[model samples]
Each structure stands twice: as structure tokens, then as C-alpha cells.
Target: MRGEGGTRRIVVIGGGIAGLATAALLARDGHSVDLVEARDAFGGRAGTWEQDGFRFDTGPSWYLMPDVFERFFGLLGTSAAAELDLRQLDPAYRVFFEPDSGPSGGTGSPPAPPSAAHAERDPIDISAQTATNVERFEAVEPGAGRALERYLASARDTYDVALRRFLYTSFTSISPFLHADVVRRAHRLVPLLLGSLERFVARRFREPRLRQILGYPAVFLGSSPDRAPSLYHLMSAMDLTGGVLYPQGGFGHLMDVLVRLARENGVRLHAHTAATEILTETDRGHRGRGRGRRARTTGVRVRDQTPGGGSERVLPADVLVSTADLHHSETTLLPRELQTYPESWWDRRTSGPGGVLVMLGVRGSLPELAHHSLFFTRDWPANFAAIAGGTVPDPASAYVCRPSATDASVAPAGHENLFILVPVPADPGLGHGGTDGGGDPAIESIAEAAIEQVSQWAGVPDLTERIVVRRTVGPADFAEDLGAWRGGILGPAHTLAQSAFFRAGNASKRVAGLYYAGAGTLPGIGLPMCLISAELVQQRLREALR
Candidate 1:
């Protein structure tokens, strides 16, 4: 229902998936929406880069949570199928674990021995069907297939509880959580909430590779298996049973569809327009609770390059939603008095792992690689420890996406589109990226090591030689380009305290009519969560405006 004011002037900051989704939904609610994207193009992290007739998805390659996409598109009076040419990947993804060393330690130095599956140099493909995956699990360890069924059963239950009572509603108040349904299930959920995902999987599976496969999904939430809450075991159910889908063109194609939907819904889109300030006015005697100062957002001050010089303008807004980095929006755009999640508060918080993204357009095919593949280091804890301590792992766990195997449009014929992601510490000091084989030495080294690791793991020895085009985006690029806090590729880690309501609230306690949406303030990380974050913002707007 439209409030007494009827149509409101809303300014949405950032043009990422969250921002685009927010603007589209708000405009549909009879609000006058103006979306400002700092970049020349919309899709912030979820963008595309084209070079020499080859295209690469800049971020978020995997498409899980079809229901979230379905609901998001449905609200816009359309469907995922209508907007995208979607296909379910047959083998969801392949897992490549660290190689086995001989029993006698005849070669190089190492701390620990390889696990049972370490002898299996060949990568294992996790199938879309549960039954097939069960067979695969049985191949790894005795009586483990049944363990997978039990684990997934629990995961599905958790997913159900989250979808019905937890995932959609933002924890703006204690009221939403105090519901009878939630209280009834609190007993069943409390243990899950308190436990860690690593423990959750370890209790079920014995094989190291199986544990890595089940626990690695926490990375999608920008968290480690040991740090993420057990409730997130639901991530397993997302791909293992529900399956993975690729929007035919690419993730960028989905972004284009969102931009089109936003325009169709009467949103005035302004690309290359950066929000300079979050204009606010004092609103005295504020009642209910966030940081204590009380002010209402009047609008947003924006800057855009003009023909002669940079021009500044104010987009008057009755309501303002920032889909930009929460830390950037609060610290850079607002005064200290009005800022929530100030730097001091962020001091104790954990930003997620930074990333080294290697996009390579390689000649010839990569049949050994699946559409999606993960190379897990045998020493998982040591790898994460290295990342946490701001040290680079020599043999790091990496993810590779070969979109060209599925989408011809991403690469030129006879060439493969290879995108690699290596999680590093969130350190801006690592420096930015470079084209070809040149970049900041620190950043380039990570990319170089990642490429070499992929070549060795996938048995593509000439991978580097076959590369026709290459680009690298490091932690510094994330910070400089997106104003990401700590140069984190995603946002805050989804540790126990940082999950759901315990995570940052979407609205400002210090400012009224001001809200935030994205991975930083959220239902949690991943593309699905970003879409859900927009919905949570709407829920806030609906009640606050009404």
C-alpha cells in the first residue's frame, strides 16, 4: 500500500544487483526512483569485462538458489526463464584435492601425510542428482553414501526453517523473531546455530575429500567452514540436490535483465553518477532504537562527469537506500555523528577473505576441467590460517570456472574462458591489477601462482602458453573500484555472531529514512542473499513508511 505521501522520491546508491533489485521493487511500489551507479555501467561486482571478442563475468559465476531468483523475478511480473536462458549444469562441479605424497617422504618437505583419497589424482565430479552423488560418495569411503543422505536431510530442514522464518525478514526488531513458529523451532535450531559448519560436516563424513566438498560451500558466504555457523549447512542442499544453473549468456546477462526491469518500472537510471553525500536533517525526540543520533535522510548528493567538467547535483529523496559497501557509505558519505558502523566499530569486525581473480582466454579446449571446479589444499586449516594472517598460501585452494564450455558467447571459437578465484587476506596493500602479464608484483604473483596451480591440478601443462588474453583483479582492485572495506571481495565473514540478526541491521539507528542493502548488511553473502537483502530493505520501508 502507498503511504499517505503517495509517491515518494527515492535515491538508490550503487548499481549492483542489490541496488538494481531495490530500485525495481521500490518503483513498482509507486515510488519515484533514481538509481546512481559510480561506475559507467551498472552491475557492480557482478559485472562483465570484454576483450578481443572474449567476455568474462567479473564476479559471482555460480548461480545457486533458483527459488530466490524465481521469487525476485516474479515480484517484477516476470520469471527467470523469461529473462534468462537458464540451464542446469549436469555435473554440478568437480572437486580436485591435493595430490598424495609417497609414504617415505623421499622428495620435498611437508608437515602432514595425505588422506586416503589423496591417491586419487583424478578429480571427482559431484553430480546434480542425489543418487548419483551418493554413488560417488560411496566410492570415496565405506558407508559414506548414507551419511550424505542424513546430512542433506538435516540441511534441507535448516533451509526450510530459514526460508520460512529467518531468511526473508530483516531483524529490525525482536518482534519478527519472537513469533510462535520461530519459538517452537528454536529448540531444533539452537544447536545448529551454536555449532560450526566444519564440525557439522566432520560429524557426518569421514573422508577428507568428502568433508572438503560438504564444507567448502561456506566460501560462498565469504566464510570459512570452521567459522560459519552450522545453520549454513543449508548451502550443501543448494547445489547438491537443488542443483546449479547458469544463465545462458552469463551473470552479466542477468544484470542487463535487471537494468531493463528497473527501467521498465519507471526508475531513472544514471550510470557514472557517484553519490557524494547522504544528505540528512535533524529529526528530534526519536523513539525506538541503532547509533543514538536522530536524523532523517533528506536526499543524496551526487556527482557525474559533464561535457566540460564534473557536475554536482542533488537527487532529492524521501527515502535513501545504499546498496554500496556499508562501510564506505557510512564512513565516506556521512558525518561521524550520523555514521553507523563507524571505523571504531569495524575494528573488531572481520571482513571476508580478499580475492585474486584471474580471467584467461585460452586457446583450445579444457576437457579435463568441468564447467566449475574447486582445487582444495589437503591442509585446509593451514591454508585458512595463512589467509587470516595476511600470508599467501604456496599451494592454495582455488576455484575455476570454464564458462566457455557451456556458453559459446563468453569466448571466441576454439578458445576457453577460464576464470579463477583464489581467496586471500583482505589487504589493500597487495595493490591493484594490470592487463596482459603486467601488474603490481604482489598481485601478479598471486595470479601467477594460481594459474600455475590450476595447470598442475587440471593436467593442463601448457595452460600459460595457451593463454591468448589475461587480466587479474586483486584485493586492491576491489577496494579501489567498489570502495570495499578492507578490500574484501565479499563483505563481513558469516561467522556465528555475524549471521542473520546478529549481523548488522539494515537501517541506521542514527538516521531515519536511511537504509542499507547488500552482502555487508544482510541475509548473508552470495547472489541469492543480495536479492534477499533488497527484500529485507523493502520490509523495513513498508513498515517505516506505513
Candidate 2:
């Protein structure tokens, strides 16, 4: 992994998982690395915040794709299980639907019980096992269960071929797929790749409720089931196959271990330092002589804002890797003369929706709750339409994470730490609603509405009073604080045209010695993908140096 040039100096901007992971890998390869963060702490969106003796994780509650975390730690010659206590969750997550919303109780087909005798026994009663729970969700519609089994079988195949073979490959260009072996496999993938999750689910399940249940994961792609490709349904297979897991203590424990490994590997972390601009030096001779020439990055201008009034400093480096939002890095931070994309690019990028997050620390715990829960709105199609059309859903589907219910370490003796998230339309256009310049009051109003909705639906008595501490994050806040374009938390919308290789590449097409990672870059969003983004960049840097 060492570079051809001895001791290459690497500078990483934005100390999120992508930045930290990239710096760690580069440092482990004996490269001199410096990691900079705008906030006082690391972990970007995944960072933790504490108030009134209650601690809450700001973002990302569920831990899927456990092997990615393991691979990252393995790069540092360590095991994640050694530093973090990983626990697999049973029943994965609980899905709550409105009563009598459909013809059948909406649980989809239940998988076979672990024991053969149990499977033979009269439909094991979920209601008997857990009183408050609804009836056992074996498919009521004729042939629906068998259809689902077939659909899952196909999804498993997609995961084996696409996820392992194509999704993980580092495609510098489309040329690699032109190879015979790659082409043959890709030809089989075309139908699945172009197919929508909505169509796939509808083809399998006769009941609308079952279709909605299986189609839920498509939203993780930042699009609706009708819009997101069926290939993405491989996410469900990932969940049912590996099962969901959560690290004991909290997700922050895993972040802490990675940070420790990075520091131990000699990666310098400078927190509370915001990078204002990426400096570059153009070849003047070639420009004056009317010949095409490439420009080289000189360094970065970073502002230290801890002192109220900040002082700016320039740091030189051989290579620059930015894990910050792609649009932000291009338009706001880089020099105007060096801007690669147009203003309209930001508009298109921001058109994607953002979310309103409510982090609550509760006084008492609910015994009936699981580690993760999703409360689907009555009308799934309308809910997503509101989000995509730049309006809040009347009853938006909300996600809740009660980590303390699974592991007592997340809260004190008799409390629960709940992290709630509801996706909302971002500002219709950039530079409006005070977001382009700073925070927006209108966005705050939307978040307050979400809190009220959660109270009425979840049956939390004295919902506001039980909240020991509360924090709200909106698109405006994300745009200002995290430098996200239009405050998009998941980067560019995971639309069919923008997924995988179609996503912004890790290396800049216009600049030399520049690379990109994080939510905005290829492999897309989620903790696992962000870590892989770092690996891709590290691999490219090594090749470039060689």
C-alpha cells in the first residue's frame, strides 16, 4: 500500500467516517496524513451530543453490513469485535401499521421457524408470544407467501452477483465492464438493474400491505419504490440474510474505536477547523501559450473558528481528499475560477429532499419496543410524493430507534435514548428560506409538526414532558453546519441515473491530485458505503503515486 514516492503527505477535509477512514488507511500505509473537521468533535452526522445527563446519537441508529466495519478494522491490523461489542438483533426491526389498513394483517410472510416441529405446529401465534402484537403475518392472499419466497430467492441472487461482483468493483471508467466476463454478468443484471422495486414487489405480493412492507427499504435509496431500481431490493436480502446488528454501548463506541486506530496510526486530527477553500495553482506558461494544461492543487485555506473571531491558515499537502459535500466543496469552498460545475448543478443537487431529525432522551422505557422501529403512514405513495414534491407529508412515515431497550448502556438506570427521523422536502430552491446563507425558521416549524405527529401516533404520554433533552436538525442546519448542499443528508438523490458508477467519481475528472469520498461520492450513502468510499480513494491514491 506504500506509495512510489516515500512518505507522501495527504490532507483530508471533513472528519466524518469517510475522512477519518481514508486518513487512517493512508497513515497505516506510512503516508503523512492530516484530518480536519469543522466541528469540535469527529463523526460528522454520526457524532454524539449530551444534555442534562442524557446522551443521544445524532444520526444513523441501525448497523447493517457488519463486514464493512470488520474490513476497516482489519486494515489497521485489528478486529472490530475486539474493540466494540457487536450484538445481533432478533426479529431485526418492528414494523407498525395502522389497524385494518388493508385486507390482511400487514406482516408479509413469516419465515419458517428455526425448528421443524415449530413450523409444523399451528401458525405460531405472534399475539400469544407478545400480547400487544398483531396476528402472525403469514400471507392471507392466495399464493402470496410462495410468491414472496420466489421474490426473495431472486433478491438473494442479485446480492450474490451484483453486490459482490459489480457494486464493489472500482470502475475508473465504463471500459472495465466492456470485458467479456464483466459484460456477460452485466447483461444478466440489466433487467434487474432497470426494474423498479415497486414493480418487483407488486409482481410477487397480491396484497397492497405486503407490497408496502417489502418496498420499505427502497426509501433508503432516497427515492420511492416506484422510482428506485429492483436491484436495490438486495437491501432486504442483506437484512434478512445477515440480520441487523447493533454495537453495545452505542454506535459511537464503534466510531471511538476507529478514531483510536486512526490516531494510533499517526493520522493527525484537527477539530474545530473549517476549510474555507481548496487552493490550486494553474500552469501559467501553457495557458499563455494557448495550449491545454492541467492545474495542480497547492494547499487548503482553513479557518480556526474556536476563538469567536477566527484566523485562517494555509496548509500544504501532496494530495487532497475531500469527504465534504461534493457541491459545497466545488461551489462554495473552491476558488470561483477553479469551479468545475455550474450553479444549476447545485440546484439539481438540492432538489433532492432533506430530513428533519428529532433526538429525544426519555425518562422511562417501553418494554414492548425493539431496538429499531418504523411507523409507516397510511398512504405510502402520497407520503413519498410530498417529500419529492417539496412539501411535508400530512402524516409522514417516521423511523424511531430506542437503543436503550436493546442495551442498557445507552441510558442511565431507568431511561431510554430515542433518536427519531422524518424525511421532509428541502427548500424548494437554494438561497431561499435563509438556508443558503444560514438557518431557517420555516424548517424548524416543520420539525415541530413532526414531534406533535409522533406524540399522537406513538402514544407517549406527556411526550414533551418525558423528553429530558431535545435537539432538532433541519436542512438549513445541515447546509450551514455540515456544508451539505441544500442540506441533503444522503448526498445526491439515489435515483436510477445517479447510483453506483453514475454517482460522482472519487477522483475529480477536472483536477489532478484531488479525490472525493463520503455521501456525495460513489458507492453512495450509509455507514458501510462511506467507509468503502474511503477505501476506493485510498486505492486510487496508491496507484497514482506508483
Clashes of each: 1, 0
How accurate locally, in lDDT, is each candidate? 0.87, 0.70
Q: Candidate 1: worst 10 consecutive residues by lDDT? A: 104-113
Error at 256, model 2, angstroms: 1.5
Q: TM-score of the candidate numbered 2?
A: 0.87
Q: Pick the candidate with the highest lDDT.
A: 1
Give the Cα error of residue 475 in candidate 2, in Å: 1.7
Judge candidate 2 at residue 66 and give its lDDT: 74
Candidate 2 lDDT over 236-300, as tens digits, reads 66665566788886867667876888899999999988888887777443344332335666678
lDDT of 1: 0.87
Instruction: List runs of model 1 lying over 4 Å from the truth.
Output: 1-5, 102-119, 175-181, 285-293, 306-308
Candidate 2: what lDDT? 0.70
After the best TM-score superposition of candidate 2, give how far the Cα of residue 375 lies from its true spot, in angstroms: 0.8
